[model samples]
Target: MAGPTILSSPSPPSEEAGTILLETERLIIRRYFLSDAPAMAETGNDTLVTANLRAGFPSPYRLSDAEAFLSTACKPDGTAYPQHNGIFVKPLTADNPSPEPRFIGAVGIIPKGDVYFRTWELGYWLGSASWGKGYATEAIGPFVRWCFDTWPGLNRIEGEAYGSNEASQKVMKKCGFIEEGTRRGAAEKLGVLKDVVNFGLLRSDLEGVKELVRDS
Candidate 1:
Protein backbone atom coordinates (compact mmCIF):
# COMPACT_ATOMS: atom_id res chain seq x y z
CA MET A 1 0.00 0.00 0.00
CA ALA A 2 1.05 3.60 -0.56
CA GLY A 3 2.36 5.63 2.36
CA PRO A 4 0.78 8.78 3.82
CA THR A 5 1.45 12.28 2.47
CA ILE A 6 2.35 15.58 4.17
CA LEU A 7 1.58 19.12 2.88
CA SER A 8 3.74 22.20 3.40
CA SER A 9 3.64 25.75 2.10
CA PRO A 10 5.60 28.92 2.69
CA SER A 11 4.64 30.52 5.94
CA PRO A 12 3.11 33.95 5.52
CA PRO A 13 4.20 36.92 7.62
CA SER A 14 2.76 37.05 11.14
CA GLU A 15 1.19 40.41 10.22
CA GLU A 16 -0.21 38.89 7.03
CA ALA A 17 -3.00 37.19 9.01
CA GLY A 18 -3.05 33.86 7.21
CA THR A 19 -1.88 30.30 7.83
CA ILE A 20 -2.88 26.63 7.46
CA LEU A 21 -5.95 25.88 9.55
CA LEU A 22 -5.86 22.08 9.85
CA GLU A 23 -4.09 18.93 8.68
CA THR A 24 -4.98 15.28 8.27
CA GLU A 25 -2.83 12.34 7.18
CA ARG A 26 -3.26 12.92 3.43
CA LEU A 27 -4.63 16.47 3.32
CA ILE A 28 -4.05 20.02 4.51
CA ILE A 29 -6.93 22.47 4.89
CA ARG A 30 -6.15 26.16 4.49
CA ARG A 31 -7.29 29.52 3.20
CA TYR A 32 -7.65 30.01 -0.54
CA PHE A 33 -5.00 31.86 -2.48
CA LEU A 34 -5.47 33.78 -5.72
CA SER A 35 -2.97 31.38 -7.28
CA ASP A 36 -5.37 28.50 -6.53
CA ALA A 37 -7.97 29.89 -8.96
CA PRO A 38 -6.83 27.87 -11.95
CA ALA A 39 -7.10 24.61 -10.08
CA MET A 40 -10.53 25.52 -8.77
CA ALA A 41 -11.66 26.36 -12.26
CA GLU A 42 -10.53 22.98 -13.52
CA THR A 43 -12.13 21.07 -10.72
CA GLY A 44 -15.40 23.00 -10.75
CA ASN A 45 -15.71 22.70 -14.50
CA ASP A 46 -16.58 19.04 -14.24
CA THR A 47 -20.32 18.38 -14.34
CA LEU A 48 -19.97 15.29 -12.22
CA VAL A 49 -18.24 17.38 -9.56
CA THR A 50 -20.87 20.15 -9.42
CA ALA A 51 -23.90 18.05 -10.29
CA ASN A 52 -25.16 17.62 -6.76
CA LEU A 53 -23.79 20.84 -5.31
CA ARG A 54 -26.00 23.83 -4.52
CA ALA A 55 -26.73 26.81 -6.74
CA GLY A 56 -23.57 28.85 -6.24
CA PHE A 57 -21.13 27.09 -8.55
CA PRO A 58 -21.77 27.80 -12.22
CA SER A 59 -21.77 24.97 -14.74
CA PRO A 60 -18.66 24.79 -16.93
CA TYR A 61 -17.07 26.75 -14.13
CA ARG A 62 -14.73 29.31 -15.61
CA LEU A 63 -11.58 30.95 -14.31
CA SER A 64 -13.61 34.08 -13.76
CA ASP A 65 -15.98 32.09 -11.61
CA ALA A 66 -13.08 30.78 -9.58
CA GLU A 67 -11.67 34.26 -9.16
CA ALA A 68 -15.06 35.48 -8.04
CA PHE A 69 -15.31 32.67 -5.53
CA LEU A 70 -11.91 33.51 -4.08
CA SER A 71 -12.91 37.13 -3.89
CA THR A 72 -16.06 36.38 -1.92
CA ALA A 73 -15.04 33.35 0.11
CA CYS A 74 -11.54 34.56 1.06
CA LYS A 75 -10.58 37.86 2.57
CA PRO A 76 -7.85 40.08 1.13
CA ASP A 77 -5.46 38.16 3.42
CA GLY A 78 -6.94 34.83 2.35
CA THR A 79 -8.25 33.82 5.76
CA ALA A 80 -11.96 34.63 5.56
CA TYR A 81 -13.59 31.60 7.13
CA PRO A 82 -11.00 29.48 8.89
CA GLN A 83 -13.40 26.56 8.87
CA HIS A 84 -14.38 26.99 5.23
CA ASN A 85 -11.04 25.84 3.92
CA GLY A 86 -9.51 24.70 0.67
CA ILE A 87 -8.51 21.03 0.59
CA PHE A 88 -5.03 20.37 -0.72
CA VAL A 89 -3.13 17.14 -1.35
CA LYS A 90 -0.12 16.77 0.92
CA PRO A 91 3.37 15.86 -0.31
CA LEU A 92 4.08 12.20 -0.85
CA THR A 93 7.76 12.48 0.13
CA ALA A 94 9.16 14.48 3.02
CA ASP A 95 12.36 15.47 1.24
CA ASN A 96 10.47 16.72 -1.80
CA PRO A 97 7.82 18.82 -0.14
CA SER A 98 5.48 20.70 -2.41
CA PRO A 99 6.00 24.44 -2.43
CA GLU A 100 2.29 24.86 -3.01
CA PRO A 101 -0.22 22.22 -2.01
CA ARG A 102 -2.32 20.70 -4.79
CA PHE A 103 -5.88 22.02 -4.63
CA ILE A 104 -8.36 19.14 -4.83
CA GLY A 105 -11.50 20.02 -2.88
CA ALA A 106 -13.13 22.15 -0.16
CA VAL A 107 -15.15 21.88 3.09
CA GLY A 108 -17.13 24.74 4.55
CA ILE A 109 -20.04 25.83 6.74
CA ILE A 110 -22.62 28.58 6.45
CA PRO A 111 -24.16 30.01 9.61
CA LYS A 112 -27.90 29.96 9.97
CA GLY A 113 -29.84 33.11 10.74
CA ASP A 114 -32.53 34.30 13.19
CA VAL A 115 -33.44 31.52 15.62
CA TYR A 116 -30.91 29.10 14.17
CA PHE A 117 -27.83 31.16 14.93
CA ARG A 118 -26.38 28.32 16.95
CA THR A 119 -26.48 25.97 13.98
CA TRP A 120 -24.19 25.76 10.96
CA GLU A 121 -24.92 24.17 7.61
CA LEU A 122 -22.06 22.10 6.19
CA GLY A 123 -20.97 21.54 2.61
CA TYR A 124 -18.02 19.96 0.77
CA TRP A 125 -16.85 18.76 -2.63
CA LEU A 126 -13.84 17.13 -4.34
CA GLY A 127 -12.56 16.80 -7.87
CA SER A 128 -13.66 13.61 -9.57
CA ALA A 129 -10.03 12.50 -9.81
CA SER A 130 -9.80 12.55 -6.03
CA TRP A 131 -12.99 10.59 -5.49
CA GLY A 132 -13.19 7.16 -3.79
CA LYS A 133 -9.91 7.87 -1.94
CA GLY A 134 -11.48 8.33 1.54
CA TYR A 135 -10.29 11.95 1.52
CA ALA A 136 -13.72 13.40 2.26
CA THR A 137 -14.13 11.35 5.42
CA GLU A 138 -10.62 12.23 6.56
CA ALA A 139 -11.03 15.96 5.93
CA ILE A 140 -14.48 16.33 7.52
CA GLY A 141 -13.60 14.75 10.91
CA PRO A 142 -11.09 17.43 11.90
CA PHE A 143 -13.06 20.25 10.28
CA VAL A 144 -16.25 19.46 12.20
CA ARG A 145 -14.39 18.92 15.46
CA TRP A 146 -12.62 22.23 15.00
CA CYS A 147 -15.92 24.05 14.44
CA PHE A 148 -17.34 22.78 17.71
CA ASP A 149 -14.17 23.62 19.60
CA THR A 150 -13.63 27.07 18.12
CA TRP A 151 -17.09 28.41 18.89
CA PRO A 152 -18.20 27.79 22.45
CA GLY A 153 -21.85 28.63 21.79
CA LEU A 154 -22.21 26.44 18.71
CA ASN A 155 -24.76 23.69 19.26
CA ARG A 156 -25.17 21.75 16.01
CA ILE A 157 -23.58 21.19 12.61
CA GLU A 158 -25.93 20.08 9.87
CA GLY A 159 -25.43 18.75 6.34
CA GLU A 160 -27.98 18.25 3.59
CA ALA A 161 -27.56 16.26 0.40
CA TYR A 162 -29.83 15.11 -2.38
CA GLY A 163 -31.31 11.69 -1.73
CA SER A 164 -29.39 10.10 -4.59
CA ASN A 165 -26.08 11.43 -3.27
CA GLU A 166 -25.28 8.43 -1.13
CA ALA A 167 -21.55 9.14 -1.22
CA SER A 168 -21.95 12.48 0.53
CA GLN A 169 -24.32 10.99 3.11
CA LYS A 170 -21.75 8.27 3.75
CA VAL A 171 -19.03 10.81 4.39
CA MET A 172 -21.25 12.70 6.84
CA LYS A 173 -22.13 9.45 8.59
CA LYS A 174 -18.45 8.57 8.91
CA CYS A 175 -17.90 11.95 10.53
CA GLY A 176 -20.65 11.12 13.08
CA PHE A 177 -23.57 13.02 11.54
CA ILE A 178 -26.92 11.33 12.17
CA GLU A 179 -29.74 11.15 9.65
CA GLU A 180 -32.14 13.58 11.25
CA GLY A 181 -34.74 13.66 8.52
CA THR A 182 -35.42 13.91 4.79
CA ARG A 183 -37.24 16.73 3.00
CA ARG A 184 -39.06 15.32 0.05
CA GLY A 185 -38.94 17.31 -3.19
CA ALA A 186 -37.01 19.99 -1.47
CA ALA A 187 -34.29 20.30 -4.10
CA GLU A 188 -34.25 20.94 -7.82
CA LYS A 189 -31.31 20.57 -10.19
CA LEU A 190 -31.54 20.90 -13.97
CA GLY A 191 -35.31 21.14 -13.73
CA VAL A 192 -35.58 17.92 -11.73
CA LEU A 193 -36.77 17.73 -8.15
CA LYS A 194 -35.17 15.40 -5.62
CA ASP A 195 -35.49 14.62 -1.96
CA VAL A 196 -33.11 16.43 0.38
CA VAL A 197 -31.64 14.31 3.16
CA ASN A 198 -30.47 16.05 6.32
CA PHE A 199 -27.77 14.98 8.75
CA GLY A 200 -26.67 16.57 11.99
CA LEU A 201 -23.99 16.29 14.70
CA LEU A 202 -24.54 17.99 18.01
CA ARG A 203 -21.84 19.27 20.31
CA SER A 204 -23.17 16.98 23.01
CA ASP A 205 -23.11 14.01 20.64
CA LEU A 206 -19.44 14.54 19.91
CA GLU A 207 -18.62 15.01 23.56
CA GLY A 208 -20.50 11.87 24.49
CA VAL A 209 -18.63 9.85 21.86
CA LYS A 210 -15.30 11.07 23.17
CA GLU A 211 -16.36 10.23 26.69
CA LEU A 212 -17.34 6.74 25.61
CA VAL A 213 -13.98 6.19 23.95
CA ARG A 214 -12.14 7.39 27.04
CA ASP A 215 -14.17 5.14 29.31
CA SER A 216 -13.81 2.10 27.05
Candidate 2:
Protein backbone atom coordinates (compact mmCIF):
# COMPACT_ATOMS: atom_id res chain seq x y z
CA MET A 1 0.00 0.00 0.00
CA ALA A 2 1.05 3.60 -0.59
CA GLY A 3 2.29 5.70 2.29
CA PRO A 4 -0.24 7.89 4.09
CA THR A 5 -0.56 11.59 3.44
CA ILE A 6 1.13 13.80 5.97
CA LEU A 7 -1.19 16.45 7.42
CA SER A 8 0.09 19.96 6.73
CA SER A 9 -2.23 21.83 9.03
CA PRO A 10 -1.45 22.37 12.68
CA SER A 11 -3.37 20.26 15.16
CA PRO A 12 -6.34 21.83 16.94
CA PRO A 13 -6.31 22.91 20.55
CA SER A 14 -7.84 20.69 23.18
CA GLU A 15 -11.18 21.50 24.82
CA GLU A 16 -13.24 20.18 27.70
CA ALA A 17 -16.64 20.83 26.15
CA GLY A 18 -18.32 17.53 25.41
CA THR A 19 -20.15 16.68 22.23
CA ILE A 20 -23.82 15.68 22.05
CA LEU A 21 -24.43 11.97 22.51
CA LEU A 22 -27.32 10.55 20.53
CA GLU A 23 -29.06 7.29 21.28
CA THR A 24 -30.83 4.95 18.89
CA GLU A 25 -32.76 1.79 19.70
CA ARG A 26 -29.59 -0.29 19.43
CA LEU A 27 -26.68 2.15 19.51
CA ILE A 28 -25.30 5.14 21.33
CA ILE A 29 -23.27 7.68 19.36
CA ARG A 30 -20.99 9.77 21.53
CA ARG A 31 -17.77 11.76 21.83
CA TYR A 32 -14.44 10.09 22.59
CA PHE A 33 -13.11 9.96 26.12
CA LEU A 34 -9.66 9.36 27.55
CA SER A 35 -10.84 6.09 29.04
CA ASP A 36 -11.76 4.84 25.60
CA ALA A 37 -8.18 4.81 24.33
CA PRO A 38 -7.58 1.10 24.89
CA ALA A 39 -10.81 0.13 23.18
CA MET A 40 -10.10 2.54 20.36
CA ALA A 41 -6.68 1.02 19.88
CA GLU A 42 -8.15 -2.46 19.89
CA THR A 43 -10.83 -1.65 17.33
CA GLY A 44 -8.78 0.55 15.05
CA ASN A 45 -5.73 -1.69 15.04
CA ASP A 46 -7.61 -4.47 13.32
CA THR A 47 -6.32 -4.80 9.75
CA LEU A 48 -9.84 -5.33 8.44
CA VAL A 49 -10.90 -1.93 9.79
CA THR A 50 -7.87 0.03 8.55
CA ALA A 51 -7.63 -1.54 5.09
CA ASN A 52 -10.44 0.60 3.69
CA LEU A 53 -9.20 3.81 5.32
CA ARG A 54 -6.48 6.20 4.32
CA ALA A 55 -2.93 4.94 4.80
CA GLY A 56 -2.07 7.08 7.81
CA PHE A 57 -3.95 4.94 10.34
CA PRO A 58 -1.29 2.56 11.65
CA SER A 59 -1.70 -1.15 12.14
CA PRO A 60 -1.28 -2.58 15.65
CA TYR A 61 -2.51 0.76 16.91
CA ARG A 62 -1.03 1.54 20.31
CA LEU A 63 -2.54 3.29 23.32
CA SER A 64 -0.53 6.42 22.56
CA ASP A 65 -1.89 6.47 19.05
CA ALA A 66 -5.40 6.35 20.41
CA GLU A 67 -4.55 9.24 22.75
CA ALA A 68 -3.36 11.36 19.86
CA PHE A 69 -6.54 10.60 17.92
CA LEU A 70 -8.69 11.54 20.89
CA SER A 71 -6.84 14.82 21.25
CA THR A 72 -7.36 15.67 17.63
CA ALA A 73 -11.00 14.62 17.72
CA CYS A 74 -11.66 16.71 20.83
CA LYS A 75 -10.04 19.93 19.72
CA PRO A 76 -12.07 23.00 20.59
CA ASP A 77 -12.34 24.90 17.28
CA GLY A 78 -10.82 22.49 14.80
CA THR A 79 -12.70 21.59 11.66
CA ALA A 80 -11.65 17.95 11.84
CA TYR A 81 -12.18 17.67 15.55
CA PRO A 82 -14.91 16.07 17.61
CA GLN A 83 -17.20 15.93 14.59
CA HIS A 84 -16.48 12.18 14.47
CA ASN A 85 -18.92 10.32 16.70
CA GLY A 86 -17.83 7.01 18.15
CA ILE A 87 -20.47 4.34 17.60
CA PHE A 88 -21.35 2.03 20.46
CA VAL A 89 -23.83 -0.70 21.16
CA LYS A 90 -26.55 -0.03 23.70
CA PRO A 91 -26.10 -2.24 26.71
CA LEU A 92 -28.92 -3.50 28.94
CA THR A 93 -30.87 -0.56 30.35
CA ALA A 94 -33.23 -2.17 32.82
CA ASP A 95 -30.83 -1.69 35.68
CA ASN A 96 -30.04 1.87 34.70
CA PRO A 97 -31.98 4.84 33.42
CA SER A 98 -29.75 4.86 30.37
CA PRO A 99 -27.94 2.12 28.50
CA GLU A 100 -24.24 1.55 29.06
CA PRO A 101 -22.53 2.34 25.77
CA ARG A 102 -19.72 0.11 24.38
CA PHE A 103 -17.47 1.24 21.59
CA ILE A 104 -17.95 -0.50 18.25
CA GLY A 105 -17.22 1.95 15.42
CA ALA A 106 -17.28 5.56 14.22
CA VAL A 107 -18.93 7.97 11.75
CA GLY A 108 -17.88 11.50 10.86
CA ILE A 109 -18.61 14.66 8.89
CA ILE A 110 -15.54 16.01 7.12
CA PRO A 111 -16.02 19.53 5.81
CA LYS A 112 -14.55 20.59 2.50
CA GLY A 113 -13.84 24.30 2.84
CA ASP A 114 -13.24 24.84 -0.87
CA VAL A 115 -16.80 23.68 -1.55
CA TYR A 116 -18.13 26.93 -0.03
CA PHE A 117 -18.10 25.46 3.48
CA ARG A 118 -21.64 24.30 2.85
CA THR A 119 -20.70 20.77 1.92
CA TRP A 120 -19.48 17.99 4.18
CA GLU A 121 -18.36 14.49 3.33
CA LEU A 122 -19.55 11.55 5.37
CA GLY A 123 -17.22 8.72 6.43
CA TYR A 124 -17.75 5.65 8.55
CA TRP A 125 -16.13 2.39 9.68
CA LEU A 126 -17.25 -0.45 11.92
CA GLY A 127 -15.37 -3.23 13.64
CA SER A 128 -15.21 -6.47 11.67
CA ALA A 129 -16.99 -8.27 14.47
CA SER A 130 -19.76 -5.70 14.34
CA TRP A 131 -20.45 -6.11 10.64
CA GLY A 132 -23.87 -7.27 9.24
CA LYS A 133 -25.86 -6.03 12.22
CA GLY A 134 -27.41 -2.93 10.56
CA TYR A 135 -25.61 -0.70 13.08
CA ALA A 136 -24.18 1.47 10.34
CA THR A 137 -27.63 2.17 8.94
CA GLU A 138 -29.14 2.86 12.33
CA ALA A 139 -26.33 5.15 13.47
CA ILE A 140 -25.87 7.10 10.23
CA GLY A 141 -29.55 8.11 9.91
CA PRO A 142 -29.70 9.85 13.28
CA PHE A 143 -26.26 11.38 12.85
CA VAL A 144 -27.37 13.02 9.61
CA ARG A 145 -30.56 14.23 11.24
CA TRP A 146 -28.59 15.68 14.15
CA CYS A 147 -26.12 17.31 11.78
CA PHE A 148 -28.81 19.06 9.77
CA ASP A 149 -30.55 20.21 12.93
CA THR A 150 -27.31 21.28 14.58
CA TRP A 151 -25.64 22.97 11.64
CA PRO A 152 -28.10 25.20 9.86
CA GLY A 153 -25.56 26.33 7.27
CA LEU A 154 -25.03 22.80 5.97
CA ASN A 155 -26.50 22.46 2.45
CA ARG A 156 -25.32 19.01 1.45
CA ILE A 157 -23.85 15.81 2.88
CA GLU A 158 -21.88 13.61 0.51
CA GLY A 159 -20.16 10.23 0.63
CA GLU A 160 -18.10 7.89 -1.52
CA ALA A 161 -17.61 4.19 -1.03
CA TYR A 162 -15.23 1.85 -2.76
CA GLY A 163 -16.99 -0.08 -5.51
CA SER A 164 -16.42 -3.34 -3.68
CA ASN A 165 -17.94 -2.09 -0.45
CA GLU A 166 -21.56 -2.93 -1.18
CA ALA A 167 -22.56 -2.91 2.46
CA SER A 168 -21.43 0.67 2.89
CA GLN A 169 -23.24 1.74 -0.24
CA LYS A 170 -26.40 0.16 1.06
CA VAL A 171 -26.06 2.00 4.36
CA MET A 172 -25.81 5.32 2.53
CA LYS A 173 -28.84 4.47 0.44
CA LYS A 174 -30.83 3.43 3.46
CA CYS A 175 -29.88 6.73 5.13
CA GLY A 176 -31.40 8.67 2.18
CA PHE A 177 -28.29 9.43 0.13
CA ILE A 178 -28.67 9.19 -3.65
CA GLU A 179 -26.01 7.90 -5.96
CA GLU A 180 -24.50 10.85 -7.81
CA GLY A 181 -22.09 9.03 -10.05
CA THR A 182 -18.84 7.05 -10.03
CA ARG A 183 -15.18 8.01 -10.16
CA ARG A 184 -12.74 5.54 -11.59
CA GLY A 185 -9.37 5.17 -9.86
CA ALA A 186 -10.35 7.82 -7.36
CA ALA A 187 -8.32 6.25 -4.60
CA GLU A 188 -5.62 3.67 -3.97
CA LYS A 189 -6.08 1.03 -1.32
CA LEU A 190 -3.49 -1.63 -0.59
CA GLY A 191 -1.44 -0.59 -3.65
CA VAL A 192 -4.26 -0.83 -6.19
CA LEU A 193 -6.47 1.86 -7.71
CA LYS A 194 -10.08 1.56 -6.62
CA ASP A 195 -13.27 2.91 -8.17
CA VAL A 196 -15.55 4.91 -5.94
CA VAL A 197 -19.30 5.45 -6.09
CA ASN A 198 -20.40 8.89 -5.04
CA PHE A 199 -23.56 9.52 -3.05
CA GLY A 200 -25.22 12.69 -1.84
CA LEU A 201 -28.16 13.85 0.25
CA LEU A 202 -29.33 17.42 -0.02
CA ARG A 203 -31.21 19.44 2.58
CA SER A 204 -34.44 19.07 0.65
CA ASP A 205 -33.84 15.35 0.35
CA LEU A 206 -33.46 15.17 4.10
CA GLU A 207 -36.79 16.87 4.55
CA GLY A 208 -38.55 14.20 2.55
CA VAL A 209 -36.74 11.52 4.47
CA LYS A 210 -37.74 13.05 7.78
CA GLU A 211 -41.36 13.12 6.77
CA LEU A 212 -41.32 9.51 5.68
CA VAL A 213 -39.70 8.38 8.89
CA ARG A 214 -42.18 10.36 10.93
CA ASP A 215 -45.14 8.83 9.12
CA SER A 216 -43.70 5.36 9.64
lDDT of 2 at 28: 73
What candidate 2 gets wrong by more than 4 Å, as runs, is 1-18, 78-82, 93-99, 211-216
The candidate maximizing lDDT is 1
lDDT of 2 by residue, 85-157 (tens): 6888877753224456677888887776653467778988898988887778888888877666656667788
RMSD of each: 9.3, 6.7
The most accurate candidate by TM-score is 1
TM-score for predicted model 2 compared with the true structure: 0.82
Please give the range of 10 consecutive residues that has the lowest summed lDDT in model 2.
4-13
Q: Quick one: RMSD of model 1?
A: 9.3
Model 1 accuracy (lDDT, Cα) = 0.76
Cα miss at 104, model 1 (Å)?
Answer: 0.8
